[model samples]
Target: MTDTAVAAPTVREVVAALDARYPRSWAEQWDRVGPVLGDFDLPVETVLCVVDCVPETVEEAVAAGAGLIVAHHPLLLKGVSSVAPDTYKGRIVHRLIKADVALYVAHTNADVASPGVSDALAARLDLVMLRPLVPAAAGSPAEGEGRGAGRVGELAAPMRLADLATFAAGRLPATAAGVRAAGDPDRLIRTLAVCGGAGDSFLRDATAVGADAYLCADLRHHPASEHLAAGGPALLDVAHWASERPWLDEVAGWLRAQFGVTALVSDLDTDPWTVHAVSSNKENHL
Candidate 1:
């Protein structure tokens, strides 16, 4: 008997390819990465990529005719006490099975990959060559290998804090709310530090590295105020979903190039919260 090339890579092969590129061990200890369901022997035709796996994204995958969904955030985090159809996460699981869609998450492993989440964010603003914000700990799974999180880079041309904020807003996906800045808007900024998700924890590191400004999401009132008061890097807060969404295309592109399989991006806005619409009274009908 002789072995023949598989018609299409099985789910197991796809998983193996991803693991080789971004080892599961590289994921933060608390993160859940890898296949959540579906058998390894199953054949995968089309894969959809998204920043988060929410109901909307699930629907998008189905509508896009995808058999697999590769998301940056894990849908099943923490031990699931129960997966009954009544629960929210349970419903998501049910939808996947009903739609015959497989779910795989990359989480922190993708975050730490070179040219990953933060790198995509930095590219959006056209930031030049730079270094990592919190260099991956030495001896760690992806460490000493030039893979890390966030980034600190120089701008193409020096611009004021306000101008940078405006520039970022224009480049990134638009949301009901635009970008917001902290510190003197007119303050000149040439060097920038950026992380995709919540990044308050890296304030000291950004400061120590002498970044002129830092861009990320989920900056609390106190932390943003205190960082500026302490003369830390100027801050720019954006929608967490928006900040990380740019990487989905990169991920899908890589999967397509490496695996030669169809890859799609889920356009569904998966962020849980929706901005409220406030209407002016002048529009009231007669």
Candidate 2:
């Protein structure tokens, strides 16, 4: 008896599948995404999906025998003079190249995808009747009924900011920083706005759309303060890692179904802020 091996999808075919779901044209002009490394003709039998393509995740991919790493963040955001093994990103590039593992990114393109980042977050928060906070341009790649940068939606019933924050902490992936809020704990919230990653940029849009609160990650102090000063929507901040982690499973499932690839979501916590220490002395010096 002869054993027959299953055929593997090439790097080009896997990337095509990803581009079909999150078209590269949907990415913002400033953003860099898509295939960053690897030969297009390389056969890919195993795929690893992750929010960030860090060294640990790279090692995890290598250990898992994954031929491709579908990362949410682009490894090279800016032009690099070299891919020398000494530099961090360079090291990553060299490692992937050495392992013959392909690296592909789907950043803002995935953000505006139909069942995109904000959509996944909204689902986690049990949001209903969702709509895009910033609607994609008509006839654009991401143009759809509920496709855009952020999402605005409603809960089953209005709740206090504290309650909502608690719900978010429980619902989101556990992380060191956990979930933090920057508004009245008792403030009533009904309509919610959410962007999976850093979302301070959308404060005005959330306010203009009449959202009661905005849930996102990487909220800066100045922006959060200014938004609250302007009486904009209340803020709920979470770990950047937790916010985008939800979409990994969805992407993996889609890849598995579409191309019969063995796709896995890396559960490693790649968020930079590891230990968050709270000061016992509450007196403000400033």
Candidate 3:
């Protein structure tokens, strides 16, 4: 039997479908998410999913003929007076506008969505029987066990902290930052927790949840050091971009399934720190 070609949805329709899953209302008050730039009426024949909507990813989207870019991070989180072509963010805006590609972001709302960012990360790590690391408020719209900032769960079997770190690095997309860990590497760990991006803010929550180890990104020195000194969970820090990139595939698949658009995930390395130089004699310095 021959199959019929599915028509792609309009940009408005695609944005609506995405908002249905990761509602704008669920986002924090300070967050600037949802559709940023584009003509809603334009038919979206292709979508590009990316962790960050930087120049490289923007070029990739244009090259791939994507009419819409679905990004995890907001391109303009703070209010801006203008989008002049001279500035960086302005250049991105001008580029997307010139290319007729719409831009949409799904920041914190996507984080707290069930089967969302952290959930996707957990799945990649093979975490089982997951629950929210920080549960949403009691009457929040997101109902169920795993709706929150991050996810906490168990490994299929206990392994040394070092082994778990290796497992995570293997599963995650490789980046210049690579993975760094705190706490005793040899410590046995089974219960695990994960937050897909910049999760240092959740260190207390991870400890409170009794996670033996927490896998996250962009953990700063003071917070990590104090947390470990206070007997908190082991920390496995990854690249912010790498930590969130896994969701691109899942989100792209959803876009394809829901709207029949040809969705592609951009594998371009957009993480700001692209190089690392280590000292001799194995004395490391970031």
RMSD of 3: 2.3
**Clash counts for all predictions:** 0, 0, 0
RMSD of 1: 4.6
Cα displacement (Å) at residue 64, model 1: 2.1
lDDT of 3 by residue, 174-269 (tens): 888888889898999999999999899999999999999999999999999999999999999999998899999899999888887799999988
Q: All models: lDDT? A: 0.86, 0.93, 0.92
Model 2 clashes, total count: 0
Lowest lDDT 10-mer window, candidate 2? 139-148
lDDT of 1 by residue, 154-189 (tens): 999999999999999999887765578998999999
Q: How many clashing residue pairs are found in candidate 1?
A: 0
Candidates 1 and 3 compared by TM-score, better number: 3
Which segments of candidate 2 are over 4 A away from where they belong?
Answer: 1-6, 284-286
Worst 10 residues of 3 by lDDT: 138-147
Model 1: how far residue 117 lies from native, Å: 0.8
